[model samples]
Target: MTYFPAADRYREMIYRRAGRSGLKLPAISLGLWHNFGDSRPADRQRAIVRRAFDLGVTHFDLANNYGPPPGSAETNFGAILGTDLKHHRDELVISSKAGYTMWDGPYGDWGSRKYLVASLDQSLRRMGLDYVDVFYHHRPDPETPLEETMTALDAIVRSGKALYVGISNYRSEQAAQAADLLRELGTPLLIHQPSYSMLNRWIEHDRLLDTLEAAGAGCIAFSPLQQGLLTDRYLTGIPEDSRIRTSVFLDESALDNQTLARLHTLDDIAKRRGQSLAQMALAWALRDERMTSLIIGASSVEQLENNVAALGRLGFDQSELDEIDATVLDL
Candidate 1:
């Protein structure tokens, strides 16, 4: 069957400019970190991609080592693009990162010029795209010279392999340094990807948000749901098939009695606000104007639809905000 995107795809989505860049990203972006892999049915993955686009999600984020086997997610997303989204290429903001262990060799990982360049090439090949909208160095490398990594990213833009360059998982100091180097190379940093949620507020405590604002770099929060902990799925107890039980990223012990109690309290607040826990969490992550977007992963199309609907009720008065701060912060 042919995939025809919704005619009013852009109507509902709110797009924000990515820092000082000319690019704009949808408030909610889809991430291929979890479900879009070989382990999942191709049809199901394709449906999620199609449904996300229909709901006005134009940014699709990926990393070379996203899949359990590494590279499988990009390959699967590539197949979906060739089959269903090839024509809409111009309408999409596709991003891929390199830095984590990908291939086994020494050149397969880290922030070295050799690793970053080779990994992005492999990523482009896997995604079947001539270039990605944003290419990122997955993390800061302590051993490699910062200049080498930033130069590689600048070269990637110059070589037409990526439209813009970004960094992920970098601390405030490291991000500031990287931004300075990219500026010297005449390629200003476009954005920064970080793990931020109500449960994990390191960015706030570490002052990374202020650093990004100072650097004029946009921020897109990944794991905004804290790997599903902020959702209602764990209101009573962990499901047998939840990520905590199934994936290494989250542990069952993370849902301690204290955390569970907080979840219940937050759930009550969400109910009073006329939003689900997940929706409230998503809204909370975007409450800051500094947040350019929030990257969300979904296992099912229905779940994706429900999550996207969070945009419907993003408003919150001082009392609601005060209650959230008291619950999550005081905890």
Candidate 2:
């Protein structure tokens, strides 16, 4: 059977202007950080991508080193793009990053001009696209000069390989510096991807959000569920097939007594609001005007559907907020 995206899908999602840019991103975006890798079945990957589109998730985030074998997620995404979504190219916001480890030796990783430019080219070839909607620096590279990294991003946009540029996992100082450089080059930074959730409130105290807003940049928070810790999936015990059980990124030992107890208090609040903890967590992440989108990953279509359902309501009230502030674990 062939899959065509639902015509009313756009009506279900609200697209917000990212900073001062002419682009508008959906409130919820899908990420290919997990499950859409080479290790996963191709049909399953295709179904997830199709389902996301069917649900009005127009933005798909990817990185150079996402797959277990590295570079395979983009390869898989490219296959899907070439097969089912070729004609709908203009309707999607496809993004890729090149910061962490990808290849080998010197040129395989980091934010240097050689690595950044070459990585985007390789990403384009792998994704079978002439250009990507957004290109990100993945992370700040202390070893590489900030100017060099910005220069490479400028060149990427100038070469017509990427339409816009973003940065991820950058501290407040680094984000300001990158914004300064990109502004000087006339490509002014558009968005910043940071890991922010109720449990991971480092951004709230770090002043990164304030800096981005002051610079007129948008922010899309990743891991908004804190790798599922914010959900009720672990209220009892670690599930056998959870990310903590199967992946290196999340660990089972994270489910300490204190963590579980804190989750119970938060879960109680969510239950009162007729929503799940995950939904409440996502809603909390998007409480601010600067938070344009909540970037989430799912192992199956069901999880994606459930997570994005958070947009159905603003689940928190004043008491819920006070309870959340009191119950959130101090990390």
Candidate 3:
């Protein structure tokens, strides 16, 4: 059977401008960080991407090091693009990043012009793309000069390998500096990708949002569900198949009884709002207008739909906000 998109794809989802850039990203963008890897079924991955597009998720985020083996996510997404979405290329925002350890040896990692340039070249080849809609430096490199990293991003844009450039995992200080350098070079930072959720509030204390607002850049949060902990996946204890049990980022120590209690408290608030814990988490993460979008990783089509349903009720009154803060912050 032939694949055709939902007729009213744009009817429900919302799009917001990325910083001051001309681009507008869907409020709930799909991320290919986990499920697009080689170990996942190809048919399942294809279904998720197609369903996401049908829901008005125009942006798909990727990194060069996304897969278990590295680079396989881009390879898989490229196959999807080549088949189902070839004609809709211009309707989507495809992004890829570098600055992680992609291969062996010194030149294979970090923020040198050599590594960034070479990594993106390999990324384009793997994705079978002439250029990505946005290319990001995945993280800050203390060893590399800010000027060199920003210059490399500028050059990538100039060469047409990417239309816009962004930075991720940067603190307010680092992000401010990158924004300045990119501005001086005439490109300007387009957006910032940060880890933000009710659990992780470093960006709030770090004031990264204020910095991006000042720099005329946008912010998109990843892990808003805190790697599935903020959802019902662990309310009754970790499921046998739950990846949260094995993640290096969220060790067992992080899921103590206190944390579980907090999850239940938060879920109670979500139930009042007529939403699942996952949906509430997504809505809460975007409460601030400065947050331009969110990158959500889904393991199944049902999960994707449930997450996107967050868009239906993104509002929270002062009382709801205070109640949520009291619960998550108390733990």
Alpha carbon lDDT at 319, candidate 2: 80
Clashing pairs in 3: none
Q: What digit string (tens of lDDT, one per residue) describes model 3 on residues 244-322?
A: 6666777777789989898999999999999999999999999888899999999999999999999999999999999
Per-residue C-alpha lDDT of model 1 across residues 8-62, encoded as one tens digit per residue:
9999998988887888999999999989878899999999999999999999999
Model 3 residue 258 distance off true place after TM-score fit, in angstroms: 0.7
Query: Which 10 consecutive residues of model 2 have the lowest summed lDDT?
Result: 314-323
TM-score computed on alpha carbons, candidate 3: 0.98
- Native-referenced Cα lDDT, model 3: 0.93
Off by over 4 Å in 3: none
Off by over 4 Å in 1: none
Give the whole-model CA lDDT for all candidates, comma-separated: 0.93, 0.89, 0.93
- TM-score of structure candidate 1: 0.98
